[model samples]
Target: MIVIQAKLIFLNQEDKQIVLDLMRRWSSCMKFAYKRLLEGYDRKTLKRDLQGMFDLNSRYVDDAIMKARSTLESARELGKSPKKVIFGGRDLFGKLQKRHINGKAYEKLKIRWQEKRKGNLYSRGDKSKKGNLNTRIEVRKNGTFLRINVGERKYVYARIEAGYKKNKRREELLQEIAESNIPYSVELKLKNGNIYAYFAIEEEYPEIKITKEKGVIGIDINAHPGNISWTEVDEKGNLISYGNMPMPELASGSKDKREYFRWQYAHEIIEIAKKKNKAIVIEELEIKDKGKRGDFSGRKSRRIRHSFSYKSLLSKIKTLAKREGIEVIEVNPSYTSIIGMLKYAPQYMITKDISAAYVIARRGLGLQEEIPDNYMKFLNALTVEELEELKEHVKKTVRNKHLKKKHLREINKAIKFLQSLESEPERVLKPLYGTSFSTYDFWRVLKVAVVTPLSPEKVPRDFSTLKELLIQGKWGDP
Candidate 1:
């Protein structure tokens, strides 16, 4: 019952110009839809509102509404510079792209990309103001080739053998695609002087297993404009290796090259996960302007928060993980950087980011960190007289005297504090005369949830629900 889907893309050169023309027309349609949105037309009513405007098919018009609606909504949510994601598709391609899964009324963007941002990249679409027919670009497929209707009964075909079936792994994918019964979608994309046919094929009866015993490879992502880091750890929270996998020192204006390098690292990580037969762990962080309105956190031109493309990296990890039969887990990112800064840097002898990544990996592994030095100072903050008074208070509480709940907790904290210094004279004496940190939040470390590292007596013994579901690709449906 596990349904998974992804794109199968290939270069389409025969009717590249025809598809490109359609893309431009699609962008025009999307802009018109954006104008209507700004005019207070809601998504549900766009069908009746802009009925004959684009002159596209009924379904294509719906597709425009969805795509345009999505484009505007995402721009608002992420505060991305581009409010208009000028993209196009119709009919089957429309259904597959899922241009707009969530529709909403979008606000006007002050900083819009008005074609002058990057030469003639978008100006051409603006000039091609004429509406396009629905049949200009059509999507169709059976068992052999994916056919696209360009114009005047002309069609372009993307053969499976010329694309995915050429690879050994993709050849298997083709077989699974042939046997699957679940629904699927296909698309055509024109990017940077190239055209790619994308098949969003669904995977039916997928096998998932959450493998135990095998240690996990916990990774910490540090995305920055000029500084990126990654750290790896085992299931026992033992450090295996760590360094900056997200390369920052790239040639200027080499976005594609930068992406290729990132793909390389992603590939290597998946290989590691596959070889070790373990799950991949990483943090889930969003990249956006979280500062006050119009006040993004950054320097003159360098925004640190915007630089953290943690979401994109996580997407790559998950996509590759699914392909390689590996598990991907995302954990909370709270305090990983702070804790790493305090203790991990000195202990691991690594740089700032690597230290943070080490802490991140251990956090993903569910390993409780050691008590920080500040906490120990706080534990020893109380004087001998105060300790004696606290001890007396504990005795008074047991004498049937009704006390507030806070009093009981304070008494328990006092007992736990005293136990740590019971046998050590230096620990008690130093605090008595020397300065110590004053705080009341010692439960931070004491109450941490932990999965004890595997040992002779610490193996996982619970498997009551193992047969119901399997993940990490260890076991699958027979």
Candidate 2:
């Protein structure tokens, strides 16, 4: 959607007062609708009652309800209670409550607060209603004017003074509005003693042409390290290029500034895809609430988990890719990093992040992964009794650290994979490698038995030393 804002010039004080009164009534209706929605009222039921309950017409009431519903949904997404929300401005409300200022300053604050509390009017677009029903724009020879239906066949007119020069999006929208029966939503807002009209129109996304026929760029977003790693692969599944970019701004910045960086990075990534004539591939990362009220995950871990906006960055990438007509492929995120660490990292002498990107690219092209022979042999070297010993050792570490229950499940999974490898290796191998012994199972077991004991806090980024350990079949002193 594209939004264009324009300043409204009232013809006289009477028209301005009429607009203000309408805004006040509209905002009050919105608050009423929001309260009803919170009390289990549906849209149709509220739509029927709001027209009769409020002094406004049906169209205005509907728009108020729509705006209220949007605000309520936003509150819910942030895990905030709608009842606790202050409609105007929470900061201004607090200041006024505390009586922080006096005389002219206090009067100014109160007016601003009133404007925020009662300064919104919205009109949804309709093709049948000539772009908009209640609020329609007429571009006349004298000047552009807005015709707003107040109520009972009464209307108020205001002149529009918005520049569209040099703005291709807005220029195109004006042309579309004039030539075709295109619908555009309008929101008239009163801010700082002036009226502004925001016009929003849906844009058609271009058709996707760039695809995996050439190859793909696999992206690995590492939240803990605050960097994004990517690997380019050819159609034949061979690595062409690989790189990493750090995002220190994401760690500390204003919300708008951080959003700017996100878009900048997204554009850069898509430009690479465009230059390579390839599709973009990334993990379909899903953030789950694994931390409970009494979990021993620690504050540092929770901060790292919450501070990073994994979905936000990924969303920006996908949105930009769509706009640029680049195809995007999302693969299962499970074990991509671990697979990269055990197999690709050591073999290719690359960092874990880049290796994971390589794996993602391969997966995008429908390529299957095979475990290395050394990793297979390393798993074969461990007996059932030794596997049991490693399991017990992992349990001891978890218990000593007071980790969550999920860690206990992970220890069990690793031990079971090893037990299967020690007994009927073919059972675990057939699905992954189509062979008698599952090679992939060995790496996971190796992670628990070998890697965890050496570095309990986190996985090492550099896996150069892992090559020798896997080759020599060293289960080490765990």
Candidate 3:
């Protein structure tokens, strides 16, 4: 049978108290019935015994016990042994012959249980007790009106009408039902003085699969504007440019930090790829000087050092990728930027171009190419403005024409580093520096001086010595 999950909300205190009392009475009645059964009375005969003792009308008492037995049997099959069953003594055989309780009365009972279930009842000095008696109840929803009568005077009346609806709301509800486990189980909870009864539905796990082919994309993480670049290549190793998304200037200086934006964008892209059933290929980044002071001059260095958010972005991307079923492959990022620069080396500068071209040529011929430290020096010397200008130049010049083989190779190589940065920089950092450092650590680890124990009288007594020790320990420099 299809079961719908529904909740009941109580309107006032009077309604709430009435429901609580009904539950207590019902629980006591069930306990008495069970006690009789344990005393060797048959299940049906026990109901007759309860009918006589409670002065309950014979028909009502018999029906209540039978219904309680059925509920108990179902609960047992479902691996649950209910402590007690709740229903009205009078209503079971009276006018409203509903099988399962619902509506306002059910909600009221639910709330009373929730409030009395928490904590020890009495203080150490007082003998007053705590904790309400345990009782089990069921609610069934059939129509707009919830009708339940617990006893002769205690009854609950409420409406089960929709709260609000948007376009396609029912469709969304249907989807949720289809995806969810049928006959879902939830803990019925009620809070005193609260207008609504709460049900905490257990989370259901769904099966997930990746349905598309594998694709690799490069990501570059930054402090200001976090960027990710994608390069889609076909099976034949040919480049596909339509898939690339480059972020040239992601404002890195904002105090608000852009980790949230990066997480949102990455998840968006990853989800798109996941829905398409494609695997992602990414480059590995090696971030160095993670727990170190900024290299900028004077006070500006200190100020700039405080603004890194690299670690937060990487963490967010990794979590999202896992949820999307993206397979991230890490490739070495060494010399990617340098190689990319060399590939675009200007034709006007023949000597330098040839030197840059030679690096790609050797790699293409399956020969090992040595990376010079000068490349790093060159990169370090290029100001942020110059890097931006170079990016603009490449964008403007490389359009509407075929890129040279040398330049294309370099760009592909640099793209690997960018991919690594975008996908999982920690993977790259682990191999290169033996430690994963990101822009986020600038605030967490490097901003403070490491405390050193002193023999009370041997205080360093100088800020420079403290700074030197901190730098030597790789925390930061003055």
Candidate 4:
């Protein structure tokens, strides 16, 4: 979607106040609807109640509820408590409550806070309304204008100016609005005593041109090293090329700067794919909130959680890929890291992250991964007696080395998988891919049992350290 920002010029104070009044009521209804939604009210019920409680009509009320619902969903996704969310600017609210600084400073802050709280309006597009009924934009012979519906058959007219600079995107959007019946959403905001209108229109994308039939470039986003690693593979699943893009400023920069860098990163990857004439493959990975308030998550966890915008970055990549007609493929993220570390990293002598990218690329090509013969033989040799001894070894290592809970869990899970296999020697575990290969559980057993403790972070970057273990079927010294 493309968004056009323009200044709204009102002819008279009365017309401006009419729009302002609707914005105030719309903001108020939004807060009320959010509270009711949190208190177990459905959208239908809240829509009816908001119309009665606020001055807004049905459509405005619906839009308010939509905005509030989106805010709530975002908060939940970030693992934030809804109760702690400040409707306006939280920092400004805190400053005002503290009563710090007097006179002009205080007044300026108060005005900004009030504007943030009550000076916003939103109206969704409706195709049946010829675009949008509440806030409609039309280009006439004289100039472009906006007709805003404030109340019962009451309307306010304002001139809209998109500025003097040349903007091809804006011009294209305007042409689309004038030529097609496609709906466009509008949002009005009062910024610094001036009214700004944001118009959003969806853009059509071309058909897929570059596809996996030729090759695929797989991407792996790593947090510890703060780099995006990519590996290109041929149609036969052979590695062709690989590289890493370091993003040192991604975690510590300002929000705007970080977002700009993300766009640049996406552009770089897409350009590489275009150059190679290959499709792009990335894991469909979802990074949920690291922890809640007062959870005392570690510094690394917090930094990674706040710094990386996985969804945003992935969306940007996919959007740009669509515009470039490059096919983008998303594969299951499960065990990509483990499979990469165990199977590909040692064999290819590459970093774990790059190895993971290789696995992602190969998976996109519809290839099945087979367990190494040596590793399979080791699993087959493990009896309940041997598993018990390994369990004792893991427990001793954990107690002596003071390993974290996660390490213990990993080792224990692997041991359990080994125990399950003792009963069924010829057992085959099938995953969602519906292949006759062993499940990730079997791999995890090998990882903890034989691959030098097999933790992604703890394992040596030179995966050759574990080469002897994998080749000789000898368990690592825990």
> Which has the greatest TM-score?
4
**Residue lDDT tens for model 3, 20-109:** 554444445555665454355676677666755654444345444654566566544333334543333333333334525578876655
Decreasing lDDT order of the candidates: 4, 2, 1, 3
Q: Could you give the candidate ranking by TM-score, starting with the highest?
A: 4, 2, 1, 3
My TM-score estimates for the predictions, one after another, are 0.51, 0.79, 0.29, 0.85
Cα lDDT of model 1 by residue, 1-478, tens digit: 1222222233555455555565555556666777687677976677765546544444445666766677677665555544444333223234434534333311111111221111111111111322122222122343344444444456554444424235545545544543443233334444334444444443332354534236667666554434446665666777777656645533244667766766667788777667666677777644443454643433311332344344555677777777666767777665565456435554556665676667766766677766554434434454445544544544554443443343445445555565555555666335333334222223322211111111112213232222122122122222
Task: Give, for candidate 3, the lowest lDDT window spanning 10 residues.
Answer: 119-128
Best-matching candidate per lDDT: 4
Tell me which of candidates 1 and 3 scores higher on lDDT: 1
Instruction: In model 2, state the lDDT of residue 252.
Output: 86
RMSD (CA, angstroms), candidate 4: 4.3
| Model 4: per-residue Cα lDDT over 1-478, one tens digit each | 9888988889899899989988999999999888888887999988888887887789999999999999988777556787778988889999999998699999999999999999999999998878888998877776678889898898898877775464556655665695586888999998888888998877789999999999999998887678899999999999989999998877786899989999999999999999999999987645433554544264433654555786678789999999999999988766888889888888888988999999999998888788887777666665656556655655656543535455666766766665554445364332223333356777777677655344333566777766766777665355
lDDT of each: 0.48, 0.78, 0.38, 0.80
For candidate 2, lDDT tens digit of each residue in 1-478? 7788888888899988998888889999999999999999998998888787667888899899989999997765444577888989899999999997999999999999988899999999998877888888776767667889888899998876675334445544564674576888889888889988888888778999998998999998887668889999999899999999898888887889998898888888888899888999987744333345433244433543465676788888998899989999988765787788877888789998899899999999999887666666565565557656655665666554545254455557776665544435553334355434354555567666556655554567777777776566554543
Cα error, residue 295 of model 3, in Å, equals: 21
What's the CA error at residue 308 for candidate 4, in Å?
Answer: 3.3
How many clashing pairs does model 1 include? 7
With candidate 2 superimposed using the best TM-score fit, by how many Å does residue 413's alpha carbon deviate from the native? 7.1
lDDT of 1 at 126: 12
